[model samples]
Target: MIKLRASRRGDGAALFDVWYRAIVGSHDFLKPDDLATIVEMVQRDYFPSTQFTVAVDDADRPVGFIEVDGDSIGALFVDPDMQGRGVARALIAATMPTDRAWTVEVNEANSRARRFYEQLGCVLVGRRETDDLGLHYPLLRLEHSAAAV
Candidate 1:
């Protein structure tokens, strides 16, 4: 069974692997160079700098992660192998502390992700021409009610 745990100091590599695989599976719209750059950046900077709540299996190895970026879910990615198995839902429910709403961003090219979030009761709130890094991937901003996750 899967369960939740706090990410520890040595979790970056596994976390990075999770992020890379998930992105590769869902973000097929990204260019090879852009994806490579993102992979490098995530490994060299983001994963180490950011703290995440990890979802682990009985072995206690990470299978998914959620990043709580203030009032937003900065990131949420589950292992492609674990997709549609409730890992993402568990992360959202565990991280969201209130019955109010919080936002999540999905790449505009990633219709599958958009539908997944919508299935969790998220509604369209806005859009962005590029991601936070000024990348070319347009983003669809969505707001999720904590009550429904």
Candidate 2:
């Protein structure tokens, strides 16, 4: 079983591992040093107690995480080993507000993630390029009121 809970400061390193592994190991999106910096930024700017949820297994081990920024999902990652077990869906359902629209950015090349958002009723809004980071991504938006199913 998986449970969603608020993130704790102590979970920083574990969350970092999840983030690094998901982005680097799976997507090859960042270099080790850059991933390290991203993890540090997440720790400093968006720790568990601050608008983040962790998916903990029956053993009480964190296997995934989702971070919220305003009405947007800043980040969502599940341990590769835990994928396809409904952990991501559970985490999103637990963290997203029932009254507001939420937005997320997905890499155009990431078909799985795009499908995940679509499954949640998110639709393509526009395309975006992180000029500062030189990364191109697509924006998806979901309105809770309109997404009811």
Best model per TM-score: 1
lDDT of model 2, residue 108? 63
**What TM-score fits each model?**
0.95, 0.77
lDDT of 1 at 134: 95
* Model 2 regions more than 4 Å off: 29-51, 131-145
lDDT of 1 by residue, 20-138 (tens): 89988888899998888888888888988998999999999999999998879999999899998999989988887576788899899999989988988889989999997799889
Per-candidate clash tally: 0, 0
Model 1 scores a C-alpha lDDT of 0.89
lDDT of 2 by residue, 1-149 (tens): 88888888688778777776677655565556665666676667656446568998887788998888777787799988888899888888777777767777776657778887887777777666551246343433434334453
Q: Cα-based RMSD of the predictions, in order?
A: 1.3, 3.1
